[model samples]
Target: MDELKVKKSPLERAKMTLSVLALIIIAACSKVEGQADLQKRQGEETPIQVVSTIGMITDVVREVGGDEVDVNGLMGPGVDPHLYKASQGDVGKLDKADIIFYGGLHLEGKMTEIFKKLERQKRTIAVSKNINPKLLRSGKDAGGSEYDPHIWFNVKHWVSATETIRDTLSEYDPEHAEKYRQNADHYIRQLNELNAEVKERIKEIPESGRVLVTAHDAFGYFGDAYGIKVMGLQGISTASEYGSKDVSKLRDYLVENKIKAVFVESSIPTKSMEAVIAGAAEKGHTVKIGGELYSDSLGEPGSDADTYVKMVRHNVNTIVEALK
Candidate 1:
């Protein structure tokens, strides 16, 4: 025999039906929230891992990439890129980087092979590669003709490099393209202003007195941009050796021109320029060491010439004060 089922009141049935609908609504909301959370996690992106060969390039990357990238420089203050060789730690950094930037045109001569190898695996860019060939200065090294890699000396040329950095970063990370462009525009404007200011400050020196002499020919672009005559005891690359003849030639130029000052480079030794100074004194010309100029690298952190802009300003002030 089967037991009889009890009949429910109409209000009770309505309440039970409402409870079932509420349970369904609650479950659906939880599912939607879970999906929303998953999407939020997926939408978050990590900063781009960037490795640069020089301090200047690292600074540009930092400026343009902003918080979107993390930049590491292989060379630091007072390090010479022409003579710098990548170490095991640098290799590890490059391997881990999502992108790599280097001053091309054989600036990092010793690291060329390493960069070439890494290019096959990731995006490796030479900031100077896209620059106009006519804008570049050509010179002869021991290996014959080569373009000078010291393009950063010219504010305008470095502006071009900054644009290249912005474009490269934008192309690689399109999501942040607008930010990169904005940052680059701001930086380029500052560079242009810097260029104009440099031109004006250079005029403080008498035309005849506007001469720059250094241990290496790294300031060709600087001299060209600022309308000053430049002479160096050594060739473009610091790797080049200078003999007594080179020193004699440079010393005679200083003496004959009646140039009052010669500058030493931050990345190079002062002994070489000191020798030239002594040689000039022996010739009855009193040439003094103007000051140290930031050549291949920026100054140490918190120094006057630590950043690219400050470095240029410091160099110009030193030159004008000593030569003018």
Candidate 2:
């Protein structure tokens, strides 16, 4: 007969579990310390550390900072900032950044609290804040925000933001101020050309076809800048919810105005817009998805709309081709 095995007491089992958790915690602490040490060593030799919230800011930082700065974009292609929140990893990135840039005016809705906290101690700047108040469109109806945050839609406004980025980077890293200025000058020229090109391309569409409709009200500045009438099912922020009433309103508008095409934003879902499309069809109106617009974010790397200029051009071309 085998001896009966004695089970450990609950207390003994609990102690063992505690011991295991302690060891795990210690290991994690050690790993984090090791990573910090490595980062510290690397930082001694690296360029200015920059963290930007959106791809548009990231692109501008990289272009202006050039080889003088290391820029990390927190939000990537198709990432909507309006609903994005900071994670533990993002906290670490923000902690390590010498400078941070974001679109202001509540564009980063969920991250506003974190940004407000960081503003107390860090060089967290809002690029959109550089825009003139007279130029900003109001989004008061959409969650009571004072102004629209989608300044990038207007090429001229974006150009102003680029200068702001340049000035900020230059102020922080004066050693590379000349380089930044040169880069900014060159980029500004490119942006000017892009603006000209966009105007020319948009001219391809007749005045009757210049109405722009989309899932959200992101294209207000674009429409204002380029002579188009814009409508949206939802408000400025994607965080805003659209209901049956909104959908019905847009459906009726589409049918009444004979707007043939609506665009889907890369960073926003197409579900709502799809419903609008179906609703219009049911009402005996034909509306198609003109193309994917780079509204809140840029396209992925190696794509045609990866860069800011490319993105603006792509959007302009799409709008023109669809509406023409």
Candidate 3:
């Protein structure tokens, strides 16, 4: 009987060990299934695909899309989207794009007509065109081609457009509506904080010393944002001719204001800016060339100011340091 009891004890111990092993295997199998389901769900959900014209919109879509969508911008960093002419590759990109996002309000100068046709089909909206007329550059007609399209200069304007973007993304991807909302919320917060920071930095320089002279008139909205008078040798679009008239006008602004510094833009030709500086110095104003500012486009890859947030921050810091 004692031998039988010892044998039974060994058998019971063996049974218990097997039971634990079975539980572990069962649990692992359940976890594996769960992970598989996750992957399957992700695969089942079709991602919203977009083709954007400009860097700012591309940056916004990337921030909002995260992993749920794929976005490609036709214009790369420092490539002026305003003057971009569609290539065969661009046409192919447009064809494959489930939704096309182009900065409306004449931003993509030659591409406006292409986007307008899509708008009639309810496939596109003028993202920046919806901003209040007052906030845009003065004298720019509200509904006319004369309007300046650089609404991204004002963060408040950009935030408003972000809501439009959020709505558009939600309409197309109803299942991911909540996700888009959260992303837009986060991005808008960043923009708000950025706007405040820019305002604060601009305030460091007194009003009398507040003139911002640059290579182009891209900063009209920026000047309107911070109450600084701005003058540029060229027009809003870098494609505009930097005529001798524009250069002389910029030189005059620097000399008349006694402004100590002028700025060069990343996308525009700096030689004209150098001329402005030289002309100012000829008048004994001694204007220094400020650091490069991202105007028409953000910086190149791996740059400190590559992203929209960093671009605005870098511009503000450089402007403040130069003027102050």
Candidate 4:
């Protein structure tokens, strides 16, 4: 009896040790709350919850917020922002978000109304509003609410918005203020380089060929930044269908101005532009489909043009090469 009761076999002890190790591994993998401990085991902590209305805004948020934000873009590649409808899942995501970011001044159409309502209840922001309204190039006069919403087509403008985003985050979480500021500065430098590169690239096009025609009115901001005159088959939003009057007016402009190209949008159907091209041809002027532009959504994830900077660069390069 004093001999410690016949000890377990060596194989049995080994099995017990293996079982305990398996349990530990399983626990580590499931550690949603024990984030730090899980990180020690090769998983990182999801430190923050950020919900953005679109893909481009996610890029900026992640750039500025760094590891502090777990960002989600509700609208992905090829989503039409003007006609976007948020799903139940998206609503849940927005509701749970610590901070919600949206491209504003009605880029999201009626979704902007919902975001405006949410501002009364929780944390949310319109990233585009950070740009000075004075800098905006509106299709209409800017006495009040008619300014363009796509300021991000201009890198300098986007950098300003990034600063606003950082400042907003700093206000919310002062402890990580410096981190957000530093991250914003890093991204801003990239945007600045992109701006210069865009200007130089556009110079490659012949001076007389700078006309830009597109399916949506998104490029007023870009045209203003780069000195191109833009006209859209549709209004400032995809929500507005092209009327016969709109098409007829565009045909007259194309023929009168001798504009040689019209571009299609990545997210929109080409039927409208086809009608424009056909109508313009009837007017004794033919237009080609210039490159497809990333107007509403960015490119699919791993491409050179997926990030906002690269997206803008790709667009500028395509526009320059085509127009040139």
Alpha carbon lDDT of each predicted model: 0.90, 0.91, 0.81, 0.83
lDDT of 1 by residue, 1-324 (tens): 899999999999999999999999999999999999999857988789999988988988988899999999999999999899888999999999989999988889779888888889999999998889998888675231389889999998888889889998999999899999999999889999999999999999999888888888888889887899888888888888889999998888888878888999999989999999899989899988899999999999999988899999999999999988
Model 3, span 213-271: residue lDDT tens: 88777788888888888877776766667677767877887787688988887776678
| Model 2 residue 227 lDDT score | 89
Clash number for each model: 0, 0, 0, 0
Candidate 1 stretches greater than 4 Å from native: 1-43, 141-145
Rank ordering of all candidates by TM-score, starting from the highest: 2, 1, 3, 4
Report per-prediction Cα RMSD to one decimal: 11.8, 8.6, 14.9, 9.9
Which pairs clash (backbone N, Cα, C closer than 3 Å) in model 3?
none
Error of 2 at 142 (Å): 3.6
- For model 4, the stretches where C-alpha displacement exceeds 4 angstroms are 1-46, 139-145
Clashes of 3: 0
Model 1 scores what on Cα lDDT? 0.90
- Tell me the spans in candidate 3 whose CA falls farther than 4 Å from its real position: 1-43, 120-122, 138-144
Pairs clashing in candidate 4? none
- Global CA lDDT of candidate 4, please? 0.83
